[model samples]
Target: MEIVIPEGSGPIAVHGFARPRPERAEELERLLLSFVAPTRAEPGAWQYQVHRDAADPTTLVFYELWRSRDDLRAHLAQPDLARFQRDRMHYLREDLEIHWLTPLTAEAP
Candidate 1:
């Protein structure tokens, strides 16, 4: 099933990649998983998912959809997220790579 992004909500989509230090892969996965539930519970979150790259287990990717830019900003300001950003270096091999996306297709049928 597809997520229904509310009409006129100006939804914002984010795509990100995080590669953990080889020795910290499992720990990084656990930390990333911890955000799933709480992030999906946030007010404007349409979707929040995490995945491990099939060919490269140490690489993690995130897909998020928020109702608006404001909502996305709010999520970034959340305490847990702030803490994660502060301590990411301990778990990641490099800085997180983030991309803001624009929908090219019409709403899901």
Candidate 2:
């Protein structure tokens, strides 16, 4: 799908899902939670949050917004993210499913 950004310098929004191995739900949650503080502290990170489904604890979700796409790219290159990518197979049932969002509503002025 083609994602169009109305403004060239607009914040980038992202939504993603990660399914943990059934037995590793808590472990995965801890690992994911560890990224929150550091990620939120990053230069261009406007928001970085994680959530787990109450009905399906193994399903993890992330909602993030960055100053720009470049910031998001830099975030993906962080050491912790690289390590997570390398080691995710041990804890995840499948790879992360990420969806980049295109804003359709104007920011409140």
Candidate 3:
């Protein structure tokens, strides 16, 4: 999975891959849910969602919306976010794939 944050709207994507272990799947789900509230409360956040692929249980994706590119960059640098990254890293087979995007129009409704 890949997250695509549009350039003008904000970060386009965040993709997470979980360990093959069944338990790791559940752990990633819990961790993602835990971030929802905090991420939604952010000043520049417009949309934030945690997504799991229906076809592939081991893949996770985060769709985020921010006020601007700077806001997205700031979010990435936040200290609180560090812990989540650290914890999730152990479960990922490879580094997360994040994409910053510039949309042609508004994102899909």
TM-score of every candidate relative to the true structure: 0.84, 0.81, 0.70
Cα-based lDDT at residue 56, candidate 3 = 78
The per-candidate count of clashes, in order, stands at 0, 0, 11
Model 2 clash pairs?
A: none
**Model 1, range 1-109, lDDT digits (tens) per residue?**
1223333447778888999999999988998999999999888888899998899867999998777877777897899888887888899888888877765542422
Which consecutive 10 residues in model 2 have the weakest lDDT in total? 1-10
**Model 3 per-residue lDDT tens digits across residues 1-109:** 3223444543344334444346576776787778899888777777788888788758777777666777666776677666656555566666676655554453533
Models, CA RMSD each: 6.5, 4.2, 4.4
Full-model lDDT, candidate 3: 0.63
Off by over 4 Å in 3: 1-22, 107-109
Q: Who wins the TM-score comparison? A: 1
Q: Rank the candidates by lDDT, best first.
A: 1, 2, 3
Off by over 4 Å in 2: 1-9, 105-109
- The candidate with the higher TM-score, 2 or 3, is 2
Residue 8, candidate 1: alpha-carbon lDDT: 46
Q: How far is candidate 3 from the true structure (C-alpha RMSD, Å)?
A: 4.4
